[model samples]
Target: MGGFKATLINEIEKLYKKKKIIVAAALALIFIIVGQLATIALRNGFGVRTVGSMEFPILVLSVVANTIIPLFAALITIDSFSGEFSQNTMKISLTRPVTRFKFFTAKLTAIILFVFLNLMFVMVFSVLAGLIFNSNTLTAYGIIRIFISYIVTIFPMIILVMMIIFFSNLINSGIGVFFLSIIVFLGFKVLGILFSDYSGIFFTSMLDWYNLWIMSVFPFIKILREFLLLCSYGIILFTGGFYLFDKKNF
Candidate 1:
């Protein structure tokens, strides 16, 4: 346990040094500023409060979860897996007193931490932006809903990371893994659009799983069903990715 903690710390430090987190943070800030500005423009020019305080954050979350968060998840996963192998850095890490499983979990745990922090950062900034710009009194209940909504998003994001990690392990090149991830992700989006009825079955389609939680009446059955689906995907991808990472020559 102690060794795993140390390795996790090392993985996090490497991610911190890589600066992708900085880029993701900056992009999120930019998106919030732009979103608020657009909202202000609409209200001033066309006389509209289309996005209220709670609505603003929710809107930001949709974009962040669907686009920004997943994009960086792929990048970070590729960098941590494929980047390490291509750069011959994984060998150095493996030289330490650590088992392959420990190394894999530590690295993945670090990525999960990155996603969680990034999500929270977006939630905080978007909430503040909404409060500052939109004059909507989010009741305590509404605030609770927003918090729950943001927190629930982390589950799907983790599953997405696991999927990408699986691909990264299969493909040796960082660039190959990145392009393949994008192609596969975009393909999934297109398929979802073309096959609306079957879209619900895809893991990518569950990015907005938070909506089930934030509903007026809790859809317990639907939430549980989707939660179980996500859990299954997470478990399978994580096990498969771990197996590949463990057996790799690196």
Candidate 2:
């Protein structure tokens, strides 16, 4: 148990040491800045007319957050496995005291933790900016709703990240995983819209879980149901990604 914990900790340290993670963190900060700026601009321009001034800002920020954060998450994970093989680190890491399953799980766990933390940070910062710009406090219930929606939205996003991590091992080229992830993300999204009738299967479009919040408009049982399903979808994709990853060989 002690050894396993140590190994996990080391894996986490390794993840943070990467330049890609640094770049991703920097990009998330940009998201924060842009979200804050956009909110302020929208409120000033709209100023409570047909829509609440805060409405456009929040909506635009949410759109940006939902669309962009997943790409960050995927880029973070893209190199996790593939990087090991490409850099020839696999020979050392896999030959260590830890089992391959444990190594993979630790990496996956770290990736998920990073994605969740980053996602929460961006959402919280955006809301804080919204508060600053609009002077409209998101009530406790509103905060809770937003928090739930953010978490649900990020689940599918992380699945996309995990899938990219799984692919990283196959490609095993520097920056290849990141580029491939972006391409797949954009392509799948297009496919999802072009084939809207079967959009549910594609994890990328599942970010629309936010629509449920608007659908219920007041947090009812139906919204709760949809939230559960959305969360389940994330779990399924994440676990399936791992299952495939475990079978992958260098």
Candidate 3:
């Protein structure tokens, strides 16, 4: 356990040295701020009704998910493995007195933690934006609902990160992982809808924020169930990524 902790610390240090966390944080801040600005515009400008209701929050969240969250997740994890391999540091990383599984898991854990923190920042900023745009007494339920809503908004992006990490190990380049992640996400949505005839309740349903918002469907129970399914998918992909990394000739 001590060894694993040491390895985790080392991986974190390496990440910091590369300014990966800093870059991710900066992007998160930018997205949150942009989301706030866009929300203000939507509420105040264009003669639209700025009623302090669930509709406003949902619209704002859709904007964030569609614009901000996707870019941040992609840039943060796009180079998950290729960055190491390209720099020829994979050899040094494997030389550490730690199991391959632990090393990969540590880095992935860091990225997920980063994503969660980014989500919190976005939620807080959105609330502040809400207050500034219109003076509504933020109710307890409102606060809780929007938080759940925004996190749920980013659920598909999180799954894409897992896919990126897994394929980053399989391919020789990070670009492949990045593009493949996008293709799988958007392509699956199209194919799932056009071919499989699957309903919007499935994981693919979450891919299109516009559809989710227009449907006016905030099925909390269903969202919770989908979140569990996403976590399960994440665990499976993470395990596969680890296995590939462990056996790869790197």
Candidate 4:
């Protein structure tokens, strides 16, 4: 436990030193501000009805998942292994008493924590942006639902982080990992669309987890199915990455 804590702290400090967290927060805020501005322009300039405060965060989240969140996920996880390998930090860290599994777990935990923090920041900023721009009344139930949606989103986000981490371990270049992860992340969505008939079998379709909240009539079974699909993929990818890391020659 102590070793894991130390490793987690070290990973977080590295992120802080690199200003990755700061950059994530900045980018999230910028994305929210721009989205709100666009919403306002459409409402006032083009006479469109903007989404209500209750719905605004969901709308922003949909856009973020497609754009900002993927980029942020790639940026954070791209370095999980490739950066360590490139800088020879992995060798030094392995020389410690920590096992490769623990090191990998710590890195994965740090990136998940970072991504969760980034998502929370986005949620908060979206609410603030809505309050400033939208005239819809905010109800406690609405706020609770939004928060729940954010919590549900963590599952898909973890799947994405794991995919990037897997690729990072497979590839030795940080830039290569970054671009490839982004490409695969976005590519999955396109493939999901192209094969909409098999979206149920495709884990990438789970990226639209937000729809679980927006369903006019809640489909509990479908939601559970999608959640399970994501969890299965996450487990498989993470296990594969760990196996590769454990066996790889540094």
Candidate 5:
């Protein structure tokens, strides 16, 4: 347990040292500010009142999930997994007393922590933006709903992380891993669009799970089904990554 904790700490420290978290936070802030400004313009200038400040976080999340999150996931996974191999640093860690499983767990935990922090920043910033611009009074219920939405968002993100990590474990080239993951993500999105009837099979479709929170009538069954699909994909990709990592030659 102590070894795993140490590894986790080391992984997180490395992420900070590399400025991954800093970059992510900056991007989140910029995207939120720009998106909120555009939304405000549309609402007041163009009379598109459908876009509210309260909905800012949701809009930012939906847009980032499709664009920024996937790219970040691929880059982070490649840096954590494949970049070490490319730089010959992975062998040093492999020679250490820590088990491969513990090392892998630490890296995965770090990635998830980074993503969670980014999500928190988006939510907090969105709330602040809403208050400043939209005169949105923060209510206890609104706060609870934001937290719930964050939790729901985690499901799809886990699947994305696992998928990228799976590719990273398979490919030693960091750039190759990144491009392959992006291609796969885009392919899944295309598949979802072309086969809307079978959208359940595409993990990309689950990325829009935020809609469940925004809907007037919550479709519990659809949410449950999408949640299950994400879990299934997450499990498969994680297992594949573990198997590949264990069998991989250092």
Candidate 6:
């Protein structure tokens, strides 16, 4: 147990050591800044009050959670699983005393941690942009809702990470896994739009599980159902990815 603890920490440390994560954050910040500027232009120039101050965070989250974060999650997963293999870091890490499951778990947790930190990074900036530029920073309730929205958003994104990890294990090359994920993601998106009635079954549709996606008043039952669905996907993907990881020749 203690060994696993150390491994998890070390794995997360390795993830943070990457320069790509830093660059990703910078890009996200730029997106948020641009969003704020656009929103300001619409309000002041066109008198089009489309978005308010309190709603900025939720708006930013909806855009990024589905696009930027998922894209980065795929990139991180590809780097973590495939890049390590190509670089032969996986072989060196496995040579340690840690078990396969422990190493996989640590890597998985670290990727999830990266997702969360990315959310926090975006959340903070979005909130500041809102409060500074947009009018009417509302009550504590609004803040709580923003916090919950961002927190709950972590689930679907984690499932996205797992899905990419499964791909990472099956494909030998990092670039192959990445391109395959993009193709599949686009395919799922198109399928969901075409088969709108059956959209719930599509992984891309599940990204809309964030509370404020469309609902003015979210139901507890609906939330629970989607939460369970995401959990099921996460379990299946993790198992399949781990199976491949365990059987890989290195």
Top-scoring candidate (TM-score): 1
* Candidate 1 structure lDDT: 0.89
State the C-alpha lDDT per candidate. Answer: 0.89, 0.66, 0.66, 0.80, 0.80, 0.86
In the predicted model 2, the residue pairs found to clash are none
Q: Which stretches of candidate 6 lie over 4 Å from their true place?
A: 212-216
In the predicted model 3, the residue pairs found to clash are none
Judging by lDDT against the true structure, name the best candidate.
1
Question: Which pairs in model 5 have colliding backbones?
Answer: none
Give every collision pair in model 1. none
Q: TM-score for every candidate vs. truth?
A: 0.97, 0.78, 0.77, 0.93, 0.92, 0.95
Give one digit per residue, the lDDT tens place, for model 2 in 5-115.
Answer: 777898889877877666766776676677566555665787623222234334643665555567666666756666566677776777678766677778777888777
Model 4 lDDT per residue over 53-145, tens place: 778898877777667776877787776578778888888888877878888999999888887877788899899888887646688977887
What is model 3's C-alpha RMSD? 4.0
lDDT of 5 by residue, 96-207 (tens): 6789889888899899887777777788897788768877555676667667776678778878898888988887788888788878888988888998999878888887
* Candidate 1 lowest-lDDT run of ten: 134-143
lDDT of 3 by residue, 131-178 (tens): 776656567866666766666555666666677788878887777777
Give lDDT: candidate 3, residue 230.
74
**Candidate number with the higher lDDT (2 or 6):** 6
By the lDDT metric, which is better: model 1 or model 4? Answer: 1
Candidate 1 clash figure, as a count: 0
- Candidate with better TM-score, 5 vs 6: 6
Model 3 stretches astray by more than 4 angstroms: 16-46, 51-58, 151-157, 192-204, 207-228
**Residue 18, candidate 6: how far off, in angstroms?**
0.9
User: Any runs in candidate 4 off by more than 4 Å, and if so which?
Assistant: 214-216
| Candidate 1 residue-wise lDDT, 71-114, digit = tens | 99889889999988999999999998988899899988999999
